[model samples]
Target: METRSLGEHERSTSQSPRVIALANRAGAPAGHVVLSAERISKSFAGVRALQSVDFDLRHGEVHALMGENGAGKSTLMKILAGVHASYEGTIEVDGTQAAFTGVRDAEEAGVAIIHQELNLVPELSVADNIFLGREPLIAGVLLDRRRMVRAAERLLERLGVAIDPESRVAGLRVGEQQLVEIAKALSLRARILIMDEPTSALSASECETLFKIVRQLAIDGVAIIYTSHRIEEVLDLADRVTVLRDGKRVVTAPIGELSHGAIISAMVGRELAASDRGAAVQDGAVVLSVRNLTLDTLGPHGWRRTLHGVSLELKRGEILGIGGLLGSGRTEILESIFGVQRGWRGGSIVVNGETADIRSPVDAYRLGLALVSEDRKERGLHLYESIGDNIALPSIGALSQFGLRAFARERALARGMVRQLAVRCTGIGQQAASLSGGNQQKVVIGKWLATEPRILLLDEPTRGIDVGAKQEIYKLIFDLAAQGLGIIVVTSEMPELLLLSDRILVMCEGRQTGLLRRENATEETVMRFAAPGMAAWPHGTAS
Candidate 1:
């Protein structure tokens, strides 16, 4: 692998505007345009999501759509994927103007889209998910199970993915589920493929595999629209880059003419400050401690231990990071600490030197502990409920009077939280489902802040949001730590773990493999402990 300083690249690219323009012109050569969108405009509820955005995809090229949250990247992709039929645009495929009525129409026109969220029924078999609507029939009336499995096998083999066709989708890992989504797209014989943040949940190794598959697909003459927040991945994978800001096209250039800083600047319309991962910080006394934590998960193969005597210490005014691959007990630790794990046992939890009895989330909260779960939609917020209601749910008792609900007090508390968190919304009455990803995350954090907890357990705090939102969340974490709150953050992004963590505890296969201070932590050093079967670090005295 080549080693190039992103800072140096940004400095050099900042001085070369003409190079960018030349690369943009050189992107699509003659007779190579496979798909083009002209003057695309879209609006929803009187708000413009996109305005006269023009984009083009060439044959055998990876065109990346870059932007911050609510910057119309997904809206524009939805237009191409036929998810939104009411948009002003001229779309041409194969040099002929075309209009799609729905997603089925787009698929029929040789277009397929893999959404950021995996859309599959977990109870269904892999084969059934791949050939869901258009299954092969034995005699036009009966379902051809054998032929469907066989066809699914062929698709998986083509992508170099190894998974059982007859296995339930629920049993597969997230990376495997992503491969299934890709296989489903390829089974449509798609000529144009749209991938939206395809690697948000994938591990480092799985990401490399997905990148290889993407390159091979491009080699096979498929035009791909790749969207991601990881700038390094974009730099490595994309052939051409198009940036959007405030719902308008900013620039389109080849990857060679762009740098990490240049692309970020284009996306946010400003030069972003470089992140300092090793900032100096003072560590206070241990505020939270766990000893001999273990959890058992019931599976088809019977009960199995997921956590094996995991232990860690979190200090007041300190950001503790838990780094590990998927299913490595990082999340389970949080769940166990929050008292939400069903079969967790043999754990002794101490809060501020007091042995705490946390039999449920209610008990955990009563003991000054709050957990911001990874699945915000399912666990953190009520999607259909009003924003004010979601914010006030956890603190209803305090806002109530004489065992009756105090509507006025509830509204006041909700308004204060919304303002404090800078949660962008029409009003407190706006449903949580209507807000953008970043604002929704803020609301989740605000809900926990309402509890006045001394310890915060955050699992993937900035999972699916864009770069701008991520920066805001990082600042929020720092602010919370400055306020003397003990924070434990579990994140898949290595840069995030290093940037926000005062000290990182690396886990592998349900064990603490290594612990390193912020100054000593690096991607390679962390991964050495995060990988399975790695040697464990020597125990250090609790600070």
Candidate 2:
């Protein structure tokens, strides 16, 4: 713990003028450090999450935080946002020492955080979620519906999105939910805003809108602390960059003071080799086949056909990619084959020349098939459970004897899977919730890998992972394909689909638009096929 006298604080406030501006917008006044964290150190279960790290924000600057998973980026953000109260540090706001006891204390001090993981109640309306705890009252006894809805609408409009304030959050898409979280942060009107992976789920158009809003906010004097893995966005939006690695600050410099290669080297301590373009496989036999795979989806009106006549053939030792924009039935295709019904799935799947009648996940596992879902936290891993338990969950029944759980067998399998995936953790007893985003994804995949499935399905395999972790996953996927596993990947990233897939099956509006080989699939080609009016409707059916 550290303490500062009033005289010392006043002396530190008078800093040299150094204006940091965004492109085309006027910069904030220099020497205006709105929030500052000095000598912050924190530990969890004897593991150092952060160690004497320092961070500061200007009055109207977009300061980007860059780091790999488990690099103390999230830990430092949590400390500054008041999620971790007990830490060896001193925080200051406007040259005054402040100790935030909780999230409320931080909010009251004009500081707010928008977490990577969304923090909205799914059952509540969009307006209700924005004004959750601090609701507007009509007469000190009744809820102020009109005021809240109007305020929510204003926030949504400011972000340039068309979302209904009255709509339930559960009905919105993942990207929409992310926007709602941003709107909630805007409602606070905080002077210091911390955003973690804000554009993870955003579409291209949505991202354009968000960047505009962020630039406008900076012009309006809202100091922003931005965290993201997207290099181009950080280079474009951030006025200054601060990188952390393994609980220590690597560097802090203006955006112009660093280059692309320099930033990657600083964060990873090494140059990341680019992935070579993999050629299409034309040798292996067809391990899986789906002809006219169709499924129903529960939309706003009623059950609608989400997939129409979607057919693809995946060969042994091949990486087949499913490419499409959001809501283009890319996920529904995998869900249909895995028997995870979106709305009464109707599809035909043949595995290794045999039909697979998968009615549920258990049935899919039994039929030599496994699926790694997109939402790892909600659908894949049990957060609070141990790594060993999560890894062995799918096959625990087979390892049991006389209806008694075989704890020893479970640990052995978990350890083997952990070794195979090169997961970074303390031991098998570590909870999945405590792991980084990349490690958590590995656990989810390991959970299904225990089933010894011949076919694997991955959805958004590296959504929020850092560059270093992404390289590891790419190598792991290549290794799995080399081991004769038929793999299908669903990804929204065009470059990833082009880099990893042997062949891409492009879809548009729930219809198969085109099948492009490795050399033929470019960003332009993929987007052209993914656009509307390219795919014909199945016979007489309508969406």
Candidate 3:
């Protein structure tokens, strides 16, 4: 779709005046054109991803690439990254024809890509990860540990990230891991950098650091290809804009040439109903209750505190949203209730008039509870298993009898969930990893649905999926709620929370700051509660 539509599809803000500084850079003197592609076309198994597409990136310019999910943005970037190269296209770099054989070839050609999903060896130290393949060696044999550490520290400092080079990659949070990827790209001496949805999972402050780095890189004459679902970032960061729809370029213009709404029109070829945000419904009863929950000072890491004497309730036939900035202990709270975060203190859970002590996910499941984790690749699915296996995993215990694993019974259960969840796959036997992101997320949800839980915990349920799939997921959530399934949705997207939630709970710095009923919750109120620094005894007076 167009820029406006894309903005509406996803959604952004400003702190300093520098937030809008990219607009001024668009009018600056042009630099050399680093790469150009002519009539580029790519197809996968007879399905065309790019058709007669023409694109070029000028050195020292931030080129914001815009498209709806599955609109070929990732495909086009992959082509440049050499992940897919058997396509019909003519690529030229610095006026010379170029061909890439693989990702290594692209890296050698000074092209680097930071994907939405980070690629880092958790067991390795930061220094080792940055120089994973091309480690500095002494006498061309042994690894030069001191030199690598020094180099990594220097690079991280340059990128404004304060991290110890000796720390293991696993010790870092998602945002820190992303920064390491960037440092690795810089280590490659990359003249061209492609960042795909780099800020999608970032907190607001983390995004600012990333934007600063991008601008500095551009000023140093590096060509940047930026893609994200958040359109305002494009309007704020891109020197030029290009929109793609259904594998074709619709428009290319400078940032000043188009308004947000106009860009949206170009993306979808028409305007969407202005009111089509998400589902709207009210009047539901609370089925799950979490009261005064706390976890004793957690170790330094992903989330410091699971819950700070936090309390909330999820109603049957209602979508309750837990709103917070990333790393604000949102996911941890969900995990605690699901019994994944053990050793929680001073919390009582009341389910349908009965109190329960849930010490593990097994215990939670026995109490009719389920959770769809945020990290689908790592925590949500069995990547090596068939779709049937993953979907039936949660309910396998109940599906079997006489202490024996039953294959036929499992397949039957899988088929039912597959139909109910509307998972699109060639067959139930397909590997879970082979399915598209939307379908993968569906499988994740289906696994929980198979458990037939009266209470469901979803953390970033629709993250990294296409618009169509997002719509389907929303409908599914509502459908489950309509069927008396109590759901607690944890999300960073404000509009999504407002649209899908019957009630909203705002968390800031691991403390419950505010609560809003459906009738009174606005984006501003939620944000205010979510902001840090205030007396922590309930910011909202609304009942």
Candidate 4:
């Protein structure tokens, strides 16, 4: 690894200045003002979720909202969407005071929100979903399916999305499904659109399409509220940016006025530590192996293969990195290994030189396996339960013997793991839902640690956590790897993959496209393998 001098760091710091300016006026006093939120504050069960945040939206502008998880971005957006009716604030829409009592009310007021986790019924067809609650009816009672299909087709055509309007949504890929969600919102005749991490599940090309749609919406005078953790996307797409930190509005400015470094510094209140791009392990024993793994795609026996004879080896004391654009089946690999996908066929899993039959989570758990799933809230924790219960849930069987619950044993185990994992909580009995985003993640890690898994599957483990918490998790991962535990990490962050992996595997369109040893791996090589258009892995140094 190369090192830079303090002089260079100082010089880089002083290369930019702070300023902000609005742009591309559409209407309204030459300012394009559409909506303004003044002194908005909200609390949940006595906990302040947002505190006196002032925000603005303009016609024909894509305004980006940014903050770490639990930093008030979602709370503010929810208020705008009328999910929280009791928030204290004054919202003026086109210089008229407005208030909403429900999501329906917000939609009636020309507001629409597309959440990170899509709200769609897979059993329904794309056309039905687009016209979902407010379907165009022939009469007051009878439905109009043909008109709905035609409308859906037109919507997709406008966005340049190629997909059957009558196709079952369940069979679509994540990216295509996201487009359908947008179409549903557009059907609402929205003047103000709130998009939360819209491109998170999109491939590079899919992202480009979404960007074009956003641009088109802006050109049509739509006021857009865009939020994402991907900084590069904000730089490319946003007209103006508003940042929130610790439930307070830190700054609101035009995109061109803020450099990438300045945005990072403002969001984090400090510079990002220069990421170390190197291996976190040495060559070690091969602990996990797969041969000819395949999964039939989802549908009524849809035979579109999501995984195709994929094979890989993960060594003990190594962080095996899985790299791919979203929807490329990188997540499926982990799910298959953890027994989440039972439709997998023609695969042999060898762990520590022994053939493993992992048909269910029980089978995987008994073999000392742990999985931190991609959607942490959906797959990792029981939100209504206490932190103690969640951390010891996997090992609860041990706490109950002969049909008797061992309360003392459970408490003792939870306490031990909490200390070991450095989990922050008001108390062991505190609700898991009460903890902050970073602490909730720690509890998830603690749950797996209690089982003492020999193999660990981590999917976007550090996403949305604060910088301090991320550093702690990295240290914990390093400690576990040092103890010879086999760790497989699936991450979207290219820098994270470069820094943590001993060996990297790049997947594209359900295929293991290429492999790189520690000495051979670089950002360029991994990206080339992961990108769909690259014919072969290119040899080069990292940028």
Ranked candidates, highest TM-score first: 1, 2, 3, 4
RMSD to truth, every model: 6.5, 6.4, 6.2, 8.6
Give lDDT tens digits, candidate 1, residues 272-299.
7755534535465899999988888887
Quality of model 4 by C-alpha lDDT: 0.81
lDDT of 3 by residue, 290-387 (tens): 89988755464543455688898777777788998876778878888878855545679888778988888889999899999988988999998999
Of the candidates shown, which would achieve the greatest lDDT relative to the real structure?
1
lDDT, candidate 1, equals 0.86
Flag regions of model 1 displaced more than 4 Å.
Answer: 1-31, 275-283, 537-543
Best by TM-score: 1
lDDT scores for all predictions?
0.86, 0.85, 0.81, 0.81
Q: Which regions of candidate 2 deviate over 4 angstroms?
A: 1-31, 138-145, 153-162, 277-283, 344-347, 535-543
Candidate 3, which segments miss by more than 4 Å at Cα?
Answer: 1-30, 137-150, 258-284, 297-305, 401-416
True lDDT of residue 193, candidate 4:
91
lDDT of 3 at 69: 59
lDDT of 3 at 270: 71
- Location of the lowest summed lDDT over 10 successive residues in candidate 1: 1-10
For each of the candidates, give the backbone clash count. Answer: 0, 0, 11, 0
Best of the two (2, 4) by TM-score: 2
Q: Model 3 misses residue 303 by how many Å? A: 13
Give a tens-digit lDDT track for model 2, residues 43-121.
9989998888999998767899999999999888888888988999899998999998998888888889999878989
